[model samples]
Target: FAAAQLQADKNDVDTRLSQVAETTAAMMDDLKVRPALAEVIKQLIAAGNVVAYLPQDRAPRVYRIDQFVLKRDNYGQFTDIIIQEKVWPSTLPEAVRTALGVKLDPNTDEKQIDVYTVVEQRDGKVTHWQEIEGKEVPGSKSDPIPTDQAGWLAPRWTVVPGSDYGRSHVTEYLGDLLSMDDNYKAITQFAAIASRVVTVVNPNSSLDVAELAAAESGDYIYGEPDTIQTLGLNKSQDFAVIKDVTATIEARVKEAFLVANYRDAERVTAEEIRSQSEELENGLGGTFSVLASELQQPIAARYLYVAAQRKLIPAIPEGIRPKIVTGLAALGRAAEVNRLRTFAADAIQILTPQVFASLVNAPAFLSRLGNEHGVSSLETLLKTEDQMAQEQQQAMAQQAMQAATPAIAEAAIGAATQDPNQGT
Candidate 1:
């Protein structure tokens, strides 16, 4: 019976996951498309790791740090992470000091300390936490850290992971570019060297070393008339070849980073632009998949967990764990969207009006269609059956009133025409 109950709970969670998949994907889509978020991800890819802190009151904030350590368990889950940061003595709040077991010294007001904030998780829950001062062992415990939060977890702090090998697009191509850059610099230096004019002094002329040095500084040196001839080295024809090579290298780097080349959008048709965009999206498929698994989903889950603990969002449902549905993956499946549209259109065409009406609410269906197409006007233009029925009734009432007006007028005329003489 216990096993059966566990299996039933698992089934319920799976059903809920399926139900919220699209909604989750849309949320992920919105997040991934943000310019700031993309920039952060690019930095993460370049730097190998980035620190992100989720405050209970606001959106998650990312910090670029030069020093940090991360350790993962056998299952490739982060088990221990430490962030070392320097804080000014004055800026350290009393509560923070208490958490770190720092006693205030009025005399050391201007000192800076290296605080190592460590968070350790075991079996998917944070189990150990320490904020040490100057890399010392655990100190005396003071008052319980004052927090409105109920969980043992500290504030939402996370280390956003990058490639496991610490390799990034920038790092991959940077070495080659560095050599190219050096070659350019060398060419400039050589060009400068070639530009130097050699002044040939006559062997017969008596020369003072100081005067000759001064003469070299001036435009013309004292020499026999013919000996003053300037010898200019011909400019190398290899510059064009070098330029082409550098440009090719730059293009390759951009390709690796999935950076788009500048194009004349006004001249290109929408279809062409979309085709290029789809191609680029496909090219980025592997990178996005890795990011979704390693960074995006984990950060989102951590955000949700902290938000739930802080009462910022509704408490998570029992026996249910939310999973992130990657928007990139969903968007890639354009065939699925096309299939859904085709199926719905065919079903609508084949079904009788009565059957369709009984099966689905027309206004609701229209509203959903509008939402799927991102068309706000469609939803606004659609009216419910009740609203349509009320409008029809109003039109009929006006028509009946117009029809009765002429009859009423004729009756009045007949009464007037019927003289009292008829009665007499």
Candidate 2:
């Protein structure tokens, strides 16, 4: 009986050993398959510009095969190939045909279009495939992708950076220019400079060229140089550099009369204007508030005006200084107002001296300097008393006309009633 028990124990041990070997072999297979699959996927992403994300709960072993068309050269030609999803990136064929453009049909099967060709006959012999046949659509030219194929690619194709989708988003700013090379270069240059300008105006927050280009040209941005001098846009952390430059020039032209007065003011000094200008530009109120506050600070306005006439600052006219200063400074305190501030102090520090100097020494700044003391350009620029007189005259005339209109209408009605009686 003891011998029989020992043999049974040995048999049980052998069974356990066999199970262990099978499990080990299965695990090894899984490890080997996993790495091979990952490598293939990586290559697909690089080569085909398509990305697929499979979920864990889905059948992990499943894969698919499909077709795609690529634009190769400037000429239009169609090359057909079958691509396996598992080895998409590495196995996909490079596009060899030149593309003048693409022609697509939503109603037609994409497979038909993928391998389409035109046959030309000469002397009863087929000479060549003259062209790739395409379907014509109304209201628009041939689509780059067949409408039908777009549906298939939508789920799998990843956009390469700075490619179709990227340019499409900024199509408006690109203007009517058709040369892709020129447009690309212009946009890149604009982006590089605008990014730096925004960073300087506000250190906090962030913006990219794409976002800036996407913004509406008319929208108010806080750190924009024009905003700093006009709308009290102290909080503006970012701006479109080209737009800002143009806006500044426009503002200068519109307010040229006032700027001239500020330049001629004799009482204000340059130092005072410069100080107030600094307060407006770098301070919470910015340029606008500084000008407004100057109306009350008679001494300061006079000092700024005197300084302006002495040529202590740039050649900005005096007439526009007070308003410009007020505009520049009007943005008010960060915690106090609702305007957007895109940059921080740190960003402002990053600006090259030339950029900041142009902003600080603006023509409007010089005019404001002359108006600070209220004695010189500030008084001449505002001529507030004269403005009040004209406003009062207009108001009085409107009121008088309002009072007489009813009386005149009543008299006309009375006259008409008398006229009927007189005729009778």
Candidate 3:
């Protein structure tokens, strides 16, 4: 069953693996998380597999293949996992030590020791946990460690598998290209050496070979008749061939990783750029789908579960599975910007009196558009129709009062001049 499941999901798994490899490679250029991301990529390239886990009080941690063992079920879902880690005795909390049933000796020197944590999951949920000391199980089977959250406190491992069984980028993609790159570098170095002038002195010539060689600025050779000749091969053609070969190899590497190449001087139109972007999106669609299903959604669910337990986020509504959206952050943002620009243009063109009059639920459509453009707060930023009406009424009332003020004063003065009481 497991073998069948592996075969069934192999294409999907490989797609996601390729995406992760490409993303990791791209992320090596990010300044904020470059160090950590570079380390993760290095491990992936070296070992072909790495594990990501979220600890209680720290950033997500990555472990190499040697640090963990994984067992997958028939559906290629992780069913059981064991992680071995070394921790200092001083780092363990007293309650945790008591729960583990280990008593530390005060006289014994504090030292690092390996702790094995085993987690078993059933039907996509963690069901059991065991902490073992060396080879001995310390705690009773029935008494599990106390956890505020229902599932394991330690987040279950998320395995990032590379291209194949031995998930390694270096092995799969860079192996041959790297060798070619080295050869190119060596050829270039030799070409540089070959460009230097060589001086040959005839035996009977009245010229000092050492002085001719020592002259820094000029190349001159003195010899009897045609005895001395400059010997240097034109390597320009050879250099061009090597350069072309190296560039082709590099371009292959970049294309494999889905990285854009800007080596050529050919001008590309906006339509071409859009077409290429769409093609890229289509190519990575499988990868995005796999990541959403296998990695992002599960990790988000775990985070929300923990948050709900701590009253950080609202409790999960019963019977409704929370929706988690995940993608490459930079790409997602660009997509959003493009979508909003398109929507704005469409809205401006369709919002004329004639078009709006023929539309149904125009208000709702506008609201939806606002939400899509991330302007759900448009109501707060702009006045409602009723509010605008009220402000217009207020402005009219003030105008009427101001317009009547001069007339009222003129009438009052005329009455004062005509009436005896007003004059007095």
Candidate 1 per-residue lDDT, tens place, 166-266, comes to 44545656787796788688678878888787866566665543676675444655445653445766556666677778778777667666676657565
* Candidate number that wins on TM-score, 2 or 3: 3
Against the true structure, candidate 2 reaches a TM-score of: 0.14
Span of 10 residues, lowest total lDDT, candidate 2: 147-156
Q: Model 1: clashing residue pairs?
A: none
What TM-score would each prediction reach against the true structure? 0.59, 0.14, 0.64
lDDT of 2 by residue, 148-260 (tens): 11111111112234332111112322332334345456556656655554323233434443555567968654344432211233333443554455445444432321232
Best-to-worst ranking by lDDT: 3, 1, 2
Q: Give each model's whole-structure lDDT.
A: 0.56, 0.36, 0.57
**Can you tell me which runs of candidate 3 are displaced by over 4 Å?**
1-48, 89-112, 127-172, 188-197, 216-239, 263-269, 319-330, 346-379, 382-424
Q: Sort by TM-score, best first: what order?
A: 3, 1, 2
